[model samples]
Target: MNHFPPLRLLVTFEALSRHGSMRDAAARLNVTQPAVSQAIKALEDYIGVRLIDRSVRPSRMTEEGELLARAVREGLGRISATLEDIRAMQTDADRQITVACTLGVATYWLMPRLSGFYDRHPEITVNVQAPASDLPVLSPGVDIALRYGTGGWREGINGKLFDEIVCPVGSPDLVARLMEDGVDLDTAPLIHVRNPHNQHWAGWEDYLAVKGITRPRSSGQSFNNYVQAMQAVIDGRGLMLGWRSITERAVLEGTLTEWPNGTHDLGTAYYVSTGVDPSKDALLFTQWLREEAT
Candidate 1:
């Protein structure tokens, strides 16, 4: 028989070590400070060493405590990762392929055309997850990802999805209103999409600099994702750099209008990236995506 302290105690200790305060750890764990302190004390007693020095304003881990904490953190992280792998396996067992993509491409571009894929391949289902800011990990469950970039993703076979050309886009009514108000295109507020990974996607400066237009104005509302940025433009908030492949449907529907003749290549393209040994379904999906884009 094996006897061990509760995993909760290790978790509590790890949280306490990370946050440096019982209250903060408690808040994170959704437990009382006393509970966190008791867990730490119990863990210390089990190890037969003073795990943390509680004398300071924010408690500091002793040398022994740091070593133990590091082991516990690594162990817990591995356990969590293993459990996620198991879950992913289960998800795959259900014959579903998961995809990660940006909201702009998913909502404005992919979703509208997904019915055709479903109709053609009814045996396979797709699960789409779009994290607001962070890129999704290409793991066992996620068969493929459509990422917006310069095709520079590591650890994957990348294929071009489509070239994205960004130019000023706004609602026709909003453009008319701006024109009526005498807001010069140079001085108009630019809606910036704040993508941390691709800062060039944010504004006219990079786009225009590449095209030899050096004096594009830079000031306005910024959003973290495409959905919010496009929404703001749709709501007459301001003019935003729009990708035609993603925003074309809206443009055709008259909800958005492209400014200055509607075309300028942003020098970047979306790519379909996959981990090593992608399944047959994943390959088929990738092929379908390429065909659809073209």
Candidate 2:
């Protein structure tokens, strides 16, 4: 019979050892300190050995702890990488094209352009998944990702789709309501998008600065995607700094109106990224994406 510590216990042990404190490890794993300590205790009990030197002020690793921790870290890292590789292989074998994108681009941009692809490639079926910012690595199911950010991803081909321009947008009725309520542009509730990238474009601050309006009274609410933000505007929730490509159609349709003529060209651009060996379907889909975006 094989005897081994549970993977969960091993992960906890590895985290605790590396961080050298139950509190820190708990924070890293988004769990309580007591939970982390319990995991450590379980791991030690399973191994029938003390892995940590808790007597020390800051906590230290015993000789056995050190060796186990190293092995666990290396083993977990390899397993994670291997899982990703296997997923990519499965994606390739499925002959399906998976696209990862921001909600705004998916709803506003891609949805409108999808018919063109369907018309041209009847044999290929494509799937679209949106707002995958929290994903650490592209999953095996994802074949291509249409990401908006600075160019140069660590592990995929990055292609620029279009430049982004931010400008305030709202419905005509909402703007009228704000005006009637004596709410100025600077004091309007600003809707923000909570993007996956930590570094994001500044909306109200940049808009006010260019207009020479300082210290505007503002309340900010965030959405996970541009589509949601636009919906809020349509629903009379608040005004948002809208991306031009995603908002232009709405503006033309009179569903949304652009507020303030000033537009800031955000340096970041949209990209279509793929794994090292993308399937032929993914390649074709990417080619179609590039042709459409350009």
The candidate scoring highest on TM-score is: 1
**lDDT (tens digit, per residue) of candidate 2 on 90-205:** 77556667787766678899989999998998767788887445232356778888776687778876678778777788888987787788887667877877665634555566
lDDT of 1 at 279: 85
Best by lDDT: 1
Candidate 1 worst ten-residue window by lDDT: 209-218
My TM-score estimates for the predictions, one after another, are 0.62, 0.59
lDDT of 1 by residue, 68-118 (tens): 889988989999999999997787675778898877778988889899999
The TM-score of candidate 2 is 0.59
> Clashing pairs in model 2?
87-140
